[model samples]
Target: MKTAKILKVATFFSWFACIGLTIKSGAILVTYLLSISNPEASKNMYESLNLFEYYNHSFLNYSIIVFYKIVLFSVEAYIAYLVIQLLKKLNIKQPFNIDVHSLMRKISFAIFYLWIIAIVHNTHIQIIGKKHNFELSLFSSDFVFLSLVIFIFAQIVKRGIEIQSENDLTI
Candidate 1:
């Protein structure tokens, strides 16, 4: 009963996060388009994030960076959606189901992809900063560990499923 309650709470939070991130990504995309016409639109991006200097530096680089940022948030929103699905489908009594295992694997892969994009985006920022002689930083390479942890958990769930299958056969 407690586990079910906790799962419910977790699902709620996941849904909240999914909605927030989706909003953030959409806002960024809209701002990007608006900034194309009115440069003032670039002043405050997606809640006071000022990338105006980046825009001033090089339009191409700015576009690439903004694109990466949008993709990062979109991926995060997708991961949250996947987590909500996993939480909804999870049964505390018999938690090692194929659907749960698959969701975990997909979540891990999505996290890994997010980590890769973060690294690339941050690296791009660093390279551009160096070449252009301006300091700018973005993204952290922390999601890789998260991805690995979830991947290991997925594997453990897979093993549990196998064991449960064998036990049923023996029974």
Candidate 2:
């Protein structure tokens, strides 16, 4: 009973995260478009990032960085959506199911993809800032460690599913 309740709460939070991230990504994209028309808009880009200098530096670099950010956020939102689906399909009484296993794998892959993008994005920022003498910085996340943990958990779940199937066949 407690586990089910916890799962319900987790599902709610995951849905909330998915919606919030989607909104954030859309707002960033809209800000980028607005900045194109009004350069002043770049001064207070999404969450007050203030990429005006980058905008002035090189339009291509500005667009690429913003696009990478959008992709990162979108991937995060997708991961949250996948969690919600997994939670919804989960059965407390019979927890080992193919859908759950597959969803776990999908989530792990999405997280891994996000990690890769983040690395590239950060590297791009560092190289650009260094080469151009700009002191720009983007917050780095420990996504590689996180993705590995989730991937390991997914593998454990896969093993559980296999064991459960074998047990059921014997009965």
Deviation in Å, model 1, residue 134 alpha carbon: 3.3
lDDT of 1 by residue, 81-142 (tens): 99999998888889999999999999999999999999999999999888887657578789
Model 1 ranges off by over 4 Å: none
Query: Which parts of model 2 have CA positions greater than 4 angstroms off?
Result: none
In order, the Cα lDDT scores of the candidates are: 0.92, 0.89
Give the range where candidate 2 is weakest over 10 consecutive residues by summed lDDT: 135-144
Report the C-alpha displacement of residue 107, candidate 2, in angstroms: 0.8
lDDT of 2 by residue, 1-171 (tens): 899899999999999999999998999899999999898888887777788888999999999999998999999999999999999999988887889888988998898899899889989998989898876767466787887887788888889999998998999
Task: Please give the clash total of every predicted structure, in order.
Answer: 0, 0
What are the TM-scores, per candidate, against the unseen true structure? 0.96, 0.95
